[model samples]
Target: MDSIDLEVLKTAAAWLNAGHRCELVTVIKTWGSSPRPPGAMLAIREGGEIVGSVSGGCIEDDLIASVARDGVSQTAPFLLDYGISADQARRFGLPCGGTIQLAIEPLSGASGLPELLARLGRGETVERRIDLKTGAVTLRGASADSTLHVDGDTLATVHGPRWRLFIIGAGQLSRFLAQVASAMDYRVTVCDPREEYRMGWDLPGVELVHCMPDDLVLEAQLDARSAVVALTHDPKLDDLALMEALKSDAFYVGAIGSRANNAKRRERLKLFDVTEAQLARLHGPVGIYIGSKTPAEIAISILAELTAVKNAVPAELLVPHATAAPMSVAGCVIP
Candidate 1:
């Protein structure tokens, strides 16, 4: 699913375009153990219709109740705090006596949300500055070279698909992985020089590149926030790219292969002077061991693992088969 922030902004823009009244709520700060983080957002329309959430449910209920009772009022932007007391924390389902602060403002044509969404559609990160006092919002394009600062009256929040995936192959598994990654809001790109593999490849929001895998990886210059998956199973194609990827900052670098093949690949990389630490970063036999026999199931397993890593969850807790009881199938034992 798309991030709740993007969904909330898009929903607010649509309501405003349709001449409906809506308010945008953003979580500016949280004290401790809050359900939502600092950038959490929610959009509430005139008739108590909601698009996103701030708290688990209690805070949303409060906002909806306010809207229902008072109707849509274009009041000055204001901050609301919840869970400030022990009883309030218990009532709001907060883990501790954590307090969350929300900035509630009315959405209008002048909010610059539509323009921001357009920029996000072009795979660009845009910073939205909202004036807490005057309620005027401005949008600015952001890049690696951009500088960011927040003042007393201006709040900035980034809105876009912040993750990217580069898959080096267009085979059946790659197709399934691309589909799943796209559903997870990862901007996915597939690179394969073989025409045979690219002949029938087709998917929405996925860029297909007929270029050398290593060259494409270098050109992409993947950052620490990106992921690279080598699925071609060809050393000449996958190995070179993986070597470069390992040297870069991509959060996840993986290759698809059988366990034995993965071991052999590691040995070959060692011969190429790759460090033990770099080799350790490689996730061979990529997905969590889930006994996934079909392509779709395997893709799900891989994406689940990637999601866990992206969210910084412990791998042991994320992999279902890792913690579950061991099982056996077809002369193969799974633990």
Candidate 2:
């Protein structure tokens, strides 16, 4: 599943390649309550066709009409504002007097979109700078922490995978998690030394590795943008991986086990020199406490918690974390 940003990029490239004039619209700023956040993109073709969205449908309709009537006449990038007054908010379908500022640039050879998409295809985070007056563009390497910056006359956006997940087991739950994470644009990897488990795995797009779990976690050079989850439920596999993962810069480290088992795993990690603080970072009872009962539901819960952490939501702002008391069977809470 291609992300909306990727879809916008792809469509713009196609339209430009086909010799059709295209205008790339990016939400640069928002006020009050907007439908989409800044950096959300929409591509408008010379015709009425569009790929992505800016504000529900009303904004897109205006954009398509603007591009079609003007025919990409603006060679340089310009800004457009919608929803300034209460009447305008109702006209553009913005709620609560919302406002959004968009940077609309006519696509050209100088846009550097093809190169930007290529770099993103290589899994490299790229910082794209567009000269709002000249329609010129510059591309540079960006770190995971880089974000979108829109100045008075320039728009710089970050593109690529900003999140990664390393799953320690290649089982049913891992399959669901991998699929969902891929859809969410997370570079996912499932590591296991067991050939039998890997041989039966058939999920596409997710990287599968046949190697020692701990070695993979250590060699992974886990960074703050990464996460590690151990679902093998084996001491030899999960314990070593957690020991390495908890000590790394991974923003989230988790293991699938009961509350008793999670407690036992922490005790084992202490013997391996994992500090109490480091152990505290480990989310033993992984996922928000949703009382999920299936592999897919558990997968959703786990990803929800991971997303909450990614968004830097305070603990008090999030739903209660799930605890592992009684054992779960087939991922369902045993009543």
lDDT of 2 by residue, 171-253 (tens): 98999999888777788899988888898787766789998999998888999899998888899999999999999999998
Model 1 residue runs over 4 Å out of place are 144-150, 183-185, 200-202, 311-335
Highest lDDT: give the candidate number: 2
lDDT scores of the candidates, listed in order: 0.81, 0.85
Alpha-carbon lDDT of model 2: 0.85
Task: Give the TM-score of each candidate.
Answer: 0.87, 0.87
In the order shown, what is each candidate's alpha-carbon RMSD? 3.3, 2.8
* C-alpha root-mean-square deviation, candidate 2: 2.8
